[model samples]
Target: MVNGPAGRPARSLTQTLPDGVRRTTLPSGLRVITEAIPTTRSAALGVWVGIGSRDEAPAMSGASHFLEHLLFKGTHKRTALQISAEIEAVGGETNAFTTKEYTCYYARVLDSDLPLAVDVLVDAVADSILDPADVETERGVILEEIAMHEDEPGDEVHDVFAEAIYGNHPLGRLISGTPESVTPMTRTQINNFYRKRYKAPEIVIAAAGNLDHATVVRLVRKALAGTPLDTGAAGPAQPRAGDKRVRVQKPHTVVLHRDTEQAHIVLGGVGLSRYDDRRFALGVLNNILGGGMSSRLFQEIREKRGLAYSVYSYAAQYADSGLFGVYAGCAPGKAGEVLDLIRQELERVASSGITAEELVRGKGMVKGSYVLGLEDTGSRMSRLAKSELLHGHLMSVDELLGRVDAVTIADVEKVAGDLLAHRHSLAVVGPFDEGAFPPG
Candidate 1:
């Protein structure tokens, strides 16, 4: 059971073994969460703001991503070069990224240097001046980024698939908007966005590794002193829902011809949302189907048949909805055969489901990967931040492992049928856009 936030001096959310996490909300509505890891020498800290690409409107399509780049260009307190240089001088790593539901500015440094990290990350996220000249310069950089996204077949097909399956919803659009959308995004619009969305209540400050909860709280307080984020009254925004819940549409098989010799294709269907309890079972089923080197898809498509050099399956979980799909990059001539085989595999899984042996192997694979991924301070820090920002709760590693182990063959079979029996979508990028994408 978890304690409520009302009266406890510290909001102790979840604790496991040698580590425990605590949360405290400042008067300005800022939520600070920290995990004390006494053994590690490094710490990771991030400021997570709840606005992301999905929250943008038609005109401000790429504003969130744009701000991600522009914010580092310069803040009122430090120039862009000085910002990176200062962190580099301390042997720390700093970076930021924008996602569909939130954006995070993070830093990794020696535990002794935690103050520098907090100071810099806070300045970058909260004090960016949004200079006009810097905006114009980054515009070209963003344009090139958009151009770069166009050239990568493997990456572009997934976005095309999203547009096909999710329709015109913001979730379906590229995180980096088109050149047209980004080129004209002015400083005023972006500045206003930063002011409106980057509020205290909508943000979370999280730290992990060799840190004191009270010390982290003090550092964040000292860093934000007079900023609006130091004081606000709204509760955290509700997890993104609505259209995301009922947003998927008819299946689509879209093809965009390119001069590339290899064809990149994504075969996917609407998947269970982050809130779905079936996710644990689905994780095991995905492992057997295409998650690793020993999985069915990689074995059949790449090893046994040599149809593709790279083949794997993945699941993208979002707040209210998600996507499950397989990606195969193969020679243009093998596109048709690859698609056929993929469909056959889906049909087979949807019918008979995985075997008992597969169930054990899948569970082992998932649990092993889960445990191994958290071995680093950075990964642990990310885990804590994401749990707070996205899920709004923490599940201890043991509890998670237990859930993974509890999934039976029946659970996997039911989820396999439930997700795979639906109308799946396909997106292909090849030299034969005219003839490559086949009818459903």
Candidate 2:
């Protein structure tokens, strides 16, 4: 039997590992996790900054995402072109992204070039030259990106559905700010925002690959030393609205009319929060539904009937709350029938529990996938840091596998029932009749 977190006789995973993989913390509050795979000579390193759209204030909305792009433009020591050239010279890949709850910059390189990766990322964050000229250019680039999303019917619909689910909360806001918001953001505003939020020494730096723990510490320390600590803003709480049961129908037959071969249909509801205890059961339940082609949704909607090309159910787990959804693209004429099939599967999961074989397969698949995620250094580092940020501690791989295995058929039925009890807000982007979606 495994001991719990509070147990006196604690298990140590570090002691059993090879000498290179180590976990350490600095006095400045940065958590450094490194894993050295001797057989392989490549490494993946990532610095996860625990701030995203959810952290943005109304005035500084989309600042996190904007900062993500601006950081790559130039730094104190390296020009934008030089930064790209240097990484490419080492056969390394570098990129950054902003999500609802966090922003990250990462690179993958040969083990010998780990120091270069660390230096580039640290410099990008610290000496982020949010040049007024580059800021203006990037603003245009961001606006074009925003326009592209606006023009895309399927993407617009999902954004609408998210707004309906979260209402006026930050969760409802688009990660890419509106054209008006993105346009007026000045270089000063961008720099001030970065200085206040991201110029912190408290962020996490994790590397996975063939590397030394002490070496990683030295590189990170030297990279971040003497940087002003960020006394970050007390970001406002993202509102968690209760279950919503409503439907909004567009006046026109097809919204954002596009000339496409197939129609895009999105159906979903308010899902569980990251803190919810039933998250594991809910995840298993989703996996059994449309996570894999062998699942019920695929068999019923695609394989058997041949109604749609793709059908899947997913849950977007967030800090405060999440959304559970299913999406598919079907023949323009078969949208209604496809909806019925999806509803039937949802109702069946809620009413009649999955078979024993199905339960076993679902649990086994979840367990296998969990283990596979640790094979890559970047994946392991992300899993460790994200779990800590969201769950307040690290949960071992065995613990996660056990949780996935512990979900019973009854638990699946309960989660299904809870989700299906509410009417879903529908978002359809296609060429169809006005009465395509009835009121929920």
Candidate 3:
């Protein structure tokens, strides 16, 4: 286990952001970040394109995601099977994903295979074959994937919440486009879309774990050498947020449809975006509210009142928008009461300022988590790339910890008050009644 600042071992495989991670950018617009650690024998490599669902236009809602799938089907020198076999043969794992604001392809491999990993990833993105047959099969696979997401209630409601919060913006759309759009996407459309977005200079390559920085950069540059120059054009911006309330009515009230003998519910509201200066304070409020077992939501709702088995609150920070959320699973009959309890806690926390003890705990948790992230190379690379994309610079560990530490009780109270105000939005799944939820 990797040790944190307080000397306790961390549980997450991707914890700890390394100070050794060096960052640089190529003239072609590719950001290069590297971390070298002696504790682990493996390394993680990734290329993060600063574009995602939000960047696509109405005519190409799922093109970014479709391109991600096509990249893995095959490249100029390797078949899809060959790419998979090569990575697995080296005891490495490779995959890619598309998010609202970014798309990334990554590999975690033995240190010796770092060069080979770089080659595979660079080729996959820069020189994909996008085979016609594979494209057809992937369309079917992605549609099924979309269906799978709908089948999971907890997952579906947040998508619903996103729709409610962001309205008709591209941000509200699913990362994977609809069955209708993806199924009918043609090869020419894919190629044209790829040329316009995928080759942007805003792409970033990041790596963490044991490796040589110069060697890794060299490998990346060499693999992608012959690729055409990036056009240097930024993608379109995401839509802004507004006061919008939308209720999606699917069949089945008290959708206690699942027989797990319990109901899952998620409550969320417009939180704070990445560039929002109050984000650090909101993070503190989240910690005190439901970020951990000792948090107020867990203590009062579960440990003290025995309302449910699990409870937590968190904030998802995006480039232009963010979400403050609370999630819990309770006995079917107690679901409505649990919602009341959560609101009550929100009101109480907002009106009555946090205690000194709570402040300490929240700060400690946030700082501790930040310190622990420096241990893995992949995390280091991800942090650099994400910070660059989201904040436009690399934030040192000390700087982040300072921000978390600087949060005051008043800061926490103010954010809680702002978040819990009537401007909030929510989504629920389970044996729930819409009447029971707090209205915006």
lDDT of each: 0.84, 0.74, 0.75
RMSD of 1: 3.2
Q: TM-score per candidate, in order?
A: 0.94, 0.87, 0.86
List, residue by residue over 354-425, the lDDT tens digit for candidate 1: 889999999999999999999888888888877877777888899999999999999999988988986688
Off by over 4 Å in 1: 1-19, 242-244
User: Every model's Cα RMSD, please?
Assistant: 3.2, 6.4, 8.9
| Per-candidate clash tally | 2, 0, 11
lDDT of 3 by residue, 53-95 (tens): 8878777779899999888998779999998999999889999
Better of 1 and 2 by lDDT: 1
What is the per-residue lDDT of model 2 for residues 10-79, given as tens digits with 9 covering 90 to 100?
A: 2212221223346655544455767667777888888877778867877777888899998899987789
Off by over 4 Å in 2: 1-21, 151-156, 199-202, 229-259, 432-435
Candidate 1 lands at a TM-score of: 0.94
